[model samples]
Target: MADSTQVFAILAVTLAAFVWGRFRYDLVALAALLASVLLGLVPADAAFLGFGHPAVITVVAVLVLSRGFERSGLVDLIAEQALRVGDRLILQTLVLSGTVLVLSGVMNNVGALALMLPVAIRLAREHDSPPSLLLMPLAFGSLLGGLTTLIGTPPNIIISAYRQDLVGEGFGMFAFFPVGACVALAGLLLIVLAGRYLVPQRAGQASLDAMFDTAHYLVELRVPEGARAVGWSLRDLHQAIEEPVPVLAVVRGEARHPGHTFHGHLRVDDILLVEAGPEEMALLEDKAGLEVGPEPPAEDGDGGGDEAGTVDTEGLQLVEAVVRNDSMMLHRTVGQLRLHNQFGLHLVAVARDGGRLNQRLRDIRFRPGDVLLLQGGEGEIGESLATLGCLPLASRNLSLGQPRMLLVSVAIFAVAVIAMVLDWLPAAVALTGAALASLLAGVLTLREAYQAIDGPVIVLLGAMIPVGQALETSGGAALIADALLALGRDWPVVATLAGLFAIGMLLSNVVNNAAAALLMAPIAASLAEGFGVSPDPFLMAVAVSASSAFLTPIGHQSNTLVMGPGGYRFGDYWKLGLPLSLAVMAVAIPLILIVWPL
Candidate 1:
C-alpha cells in the first residue's frame, strides 16, 4: 500500500510537470525516472536497461527509415501527380489527405505530414482556397494513418513491446491492421466528408509574401550628395538613428553588400534597405539627412535591381522558411547564431503565432514553427536552410534524391517491409538492417541519418519505460485496475473497456502519446487479468486511445505544427477534432472486440 501511494504521488507530479510546459518533456521524464530510483521503487541496475530495449531500437531505426523515405523524392513524385487533379476542393482534399494517410502508414506520421505540408499550401494558393480547409485534414490524416501500422506511432510500438514482455512474442508488423485499419478508415472518412464544413476558415500563411507583408516594414533610404550621413560607416549611420530599425543591406553601383559585413563608409547615391516603420523612417530621414526613395526595381534575370542601375540588389534574395522542432536556430538569438558572420545570411524578419513579430531581429529568439525571412545568396540559401534544420515555405521541386536514387531507396524500403512481414527477422533487426542499408546505398549520409533521430523522444521512451515498470511491479497498476473494476462491476465488461479507452484518450491529450501508452498499458493488462479475458483486446484499446489526441493543439505535434500555417487558434481544433475523435472511439471499440475477442 505504501509503495502504491508513493508511485501515485510520483506520477501525479510527473503529469503536472508535463502539462506545465515550462521544461522540455525529455527532461521532465528523466526527472521522474531518477525519482523512482532514489525512492527505491526501481532498481538502480534496471534503471538504464530501457535504453537498450528492443522498442527503443525499433523507434530509432524507424526514424532513420522515415528520413530515407523523405529524401527519396518518391513523395514528391506522388504529390506532383495529385496536383494535376485540378481545383476541386473535395477531390484535392481526398487525394492530398489520402496520400499523406498512405505515406504515414509506411513512414513516421510526422515525417509524412512534413512532406505534404508545402504541397497542401501550394494547392491552397493555386485554388485560392483557404488553407484552413486543407491543412487540418492533412494533419489529421497523418494521425489516422499511424493507427494502421505498428511503426506508424510510438504508442503502438510501446504497446507491442509490452505485449512481448507479457506473452513472449511481440505483435507482427501487420497485427495492428485488423482493428487499426478499420478505425483509421472511419476517422479518415469523417475528415474528408465533414472536415470542410467543420473546420473554421481563417487567413492562413498561405503564401510566402502574404505571411510576412515585408513591404510595410521595409524602407529604402537614399544618400544624397553632400548629405550628413555620406562617408559615414554603416555602424555610424545605425547608431545615429536612435531607433531599433536595422539596416538590412546597402546597394551601390550594382553591388549589394550586406549591412553587417560592409565596413566601408557609406557613399552618395547608396540605397540602404532598412527594416523600419513610419516613425523609424521619419527619424532616419530627419536625423541622418537621408531621403526615402522607391524600392530598387528588378531587371530581367536579376532578382532585384534599381532602374537607374545605381542601386543593384543583386545576389541577395529573401527566402521564407519555418524553424523545425529540431532546428539549430531554436532558443538561439540571431546575434548568437552570428547569422551574417557564420552563415552569410541576414535575419530580415520573423513571424509567429499567425502574426509578424515586432521585436528587434537581433533580440528575437527562434522557436519551432516560427517563420523567418532570410536574405542571402540564392545559390547557398538552400544549403543553409538544410544545415539550420529549417523548411522553406516556398513551393519548389525537391532536389535531394533525383531520378536514380529514388529507385534505390524504394527498393531498400521494400526489402525491409518484406522481411518484417515474412517474420524472417524481428522488427528491430530488420529495421536496423534497413537503416544501415540506407546509409550504405547513399540514400542518406551518416550525418543526415544521425540528425533524423529525434533525441528528445528517444530520451523520453528510454527514461519512462523503467518508471512505467515500477508502477506495475509496485502493485500500483493492479490497485488502480481494482478500483475501476469495482466501480463498473454492475455494468457490462464492455463498459469497462470503454472507460479504460476514454481515460487513455484523455491522458494522451495532456501528455505525450508514447508516455500515455507506457502508463496505461500496465493497467490494461491488469484489467484483463481481473476480468479473466485475453489482454489482446485491452492492449489494442490502449494503443488506439493513446493515439487519438485530436482535441487540442498541444495534444500532438501534428496539430501544433499546422496551427501557425493554417491560422488556427487554440479553440479552433475542437470544432473538427472533437467530432473526429468521437468517431474514432465509436468505430474502434466494436472493431477491437471483434478482432481480438474480449
Candidate 2:
C-alpha cells in the first residue's frame, strides 16, 4: 500500500509536468524514473533495462528505415503523382490523406507526415486554398494510419511489448490490421467528406513573401560616392546602427555578397539588402550616411510590386525551411549557430505560430517547427538544410525516379515485413537487419541515419518503460484498477472497456502517446485480471485510444509540426479533432469487441 501511494505521487507529478509544457517530456519521464528509484519502488539495477527494450530498438530501426525510404527517392516519386491530381478539394484531400495513411502504417507516423507535408502545401498553393484546409486532415491521417499495424506507432508497439511480457508472445505484425484498417478507413472518409470543412480558413505562412511580409521590413540602402559609409567595413557599419537591423546581402553592381560573411569595406554603389523597420532604416541613414535606394524589382512569378526580398539572383537563393524537432538549433540563437560563418546562410526573417517574430534576428532562438526564411548560395542551400536538420517548405526538385535504389530499398523493406509475418525473427531483429541492409546498400549515409532517430522520443520511451513496470510491480496499477472497477461494477463489461478507452484518449491529449500507453497499459492489465478476462480486448482499447490524440496541437508531434505552417491557433485543433475523435471511438469499440472478444 505504501509503495503504491509513492508511485501514484510520482506519476501525478510527472503528468502535471507534461501538461505544464515548461520542460521536455523526456526530462519529465527521466525525473519520474529517478523518483521511483529513490523511493525503492524500482531497483536501481533494473531501472536502465528499459533502454534496451525491444520496443525501443524497433522504434530506432523504424526511424532509420523511414530515412532510407526518403533517400531512395521513392517518396518523392509518389509525391509527384499526388500533385498531378486535379485541384478539387475533396479529391486532393483523399489522395493526400490516403497516401500518408498507407505510409504511416509502414514508417514512423511523424516521419511519414513530414514527407507528405511539402506535397500538401504545394496542393494548397496550386488550388489557391488555405493550407489550413489541408494540413489538419493530413496530420489526423498520420494518427489514424498508425492504428493498423503493430509497428505503425509507438503506442501499438508499447502495448504489444506489454502483452509479450505477460503472455510470452506479442501481437503479430498484421494483427492490428482487422480493427485498425476499418477504423482508419472510417476516419479517412470523415476527413474527406466533412472534416475538411471544419478546418478554419487562415492565411498561413505558405509562401516566401506570405510568411514574413518582407516588403515591409526589407529595404535597400545604397552607398553614394563620398558618403561617410563608403570606407566603413561591414562590421563597422553594424556597430553604427542603433537597432538590430540585419544586413542580409550586399549587391555591388551585379556581384552579390552574403552580409554575414562579407569582410570587404563598403564602397560607393553598394546596395545593402537590410532587414529593418522604419525607425532603424532612418537611424542607418542618419548615423552612417546610407541613403534608401530604390527597391529591387521582384523576380518572375513573384507578382512584382512591393514584393521586396523575394528574389533569387543568379547565384543566390532565398529558401524557406522549417526546423525539425530533433534540430540542433533548438533553444540556440542564430549567433550561437553561426549560420553565417559556418553554413554561409543568412537569417532573413522568422515566423512562429502564425505571426512574425519581433525580436532581432540574431537574438531569436530557434525552436522546433519555426519557419525560417534563409538566404544562402544556391548550390549550398540544399546541403545546408539537410545538415541543420531542417525541411524545405517548397517542393523539392529531383529527377523523376531512381529505379535501382528504389527497388533495392523496397525489396529490403518487403523482406523485413515477410520475416515478421512468418515469425522468422522478432520484429526488432527483422527491422534492425533491414536497417543494416539499407545502410550497406547506400540508401542513407551514416550521419543521415543517426539524424533520423528522434532523440527526445527515444529518451522518453526508454525512461518511461521502467517507471511503467514499477507501477505494476508496486501494485499501484491494481489499486487504481480496483477503484475504477468498483464504480463500473453495475455496468456491462463493454462499458468498462469504453471507460478505459475514454481515459486513454483524454490522457493522451495531455501527454505523449507513448507515455500515455506506458502509464495506462499496466492499469489495463490489472483491470483485465480483476474481471477474470483475457487482457487482449483491454490492451487493444488502450492502444487505439492512446493514438487517438486529436484534440490539441500538443497532443502529438504531427499536430505540432503543422501548427505554424498551417497558421492554426491552439483552439483551432478541436474544431475538426473533436468530431473526428468521436467518430473514431464509435468505430473502434465494437470492432475491438468483435476482434478480441472477452
Best by TM-score: 2
Worst ten in a row by lDDT for model 2: 307-316
Q: Please provide, for model 1 over 1-598, each residue's C-alpha lDDT reduced to its tens digit, 9 standing for 90 to 100.
A: 4988899999999999988766668889999999999999999999999899889999999999988877888888888887787888888889888998899898889888888888888888888888878988998899889999889999989999999999988888889998888888888888889988998877545344576655555667899887889989865775687443557788898887777567899888998887675566677878888887664555422343332222333344777777765567878887678776577677777877667777666578787677788877777787788788787766777454576778888888788889989989889999999999999989888988987888878999999999999999999999999999999999988999999999999999889899999999999999999999999999999999999999887777777677777777778888888898889999999989988997
Model 1, residue pairs in steric clash: none
Measured against the true structure, the TM-scores of the candidates, in listed sequence, are: 0.90, 0.93
- Cα lDDT, all candidates: 0.83, 0.86
- C-alpha RMSD values across all candidates: 3.7, 2.7
Q: How would you encode candidate 2's per-residue C-alpha lDDT over 1-598 as one tens digit per residue?
A: 4998898999999999998876778888999999889889889999899999999999999999998998898888888899998978999989999999999999999988988998888888877888888889999999999999988999999999999999999999999999999999999999999966798887644443477655556667899887889889876886676344667789987778777668899988899888776567777888888887765554532454443433333343677788876567878887678787689787777888767777777678887678888887778888898788787876667554568989999999999999999999999999999999999998888988997888889999999999999889988899999998999899998999999999999999989999999999999999999999999999999999999999998899898888878878889888899988899999999999999999
**Error in Å for residue 398 of model 2:** 3.7
TM-score quality measure for candidate 2: 0.93
Report the number of the highest-lDDT candidate. 2
Question: Candidate 2: deviation at residue 29, Å?
Answer: 2.0
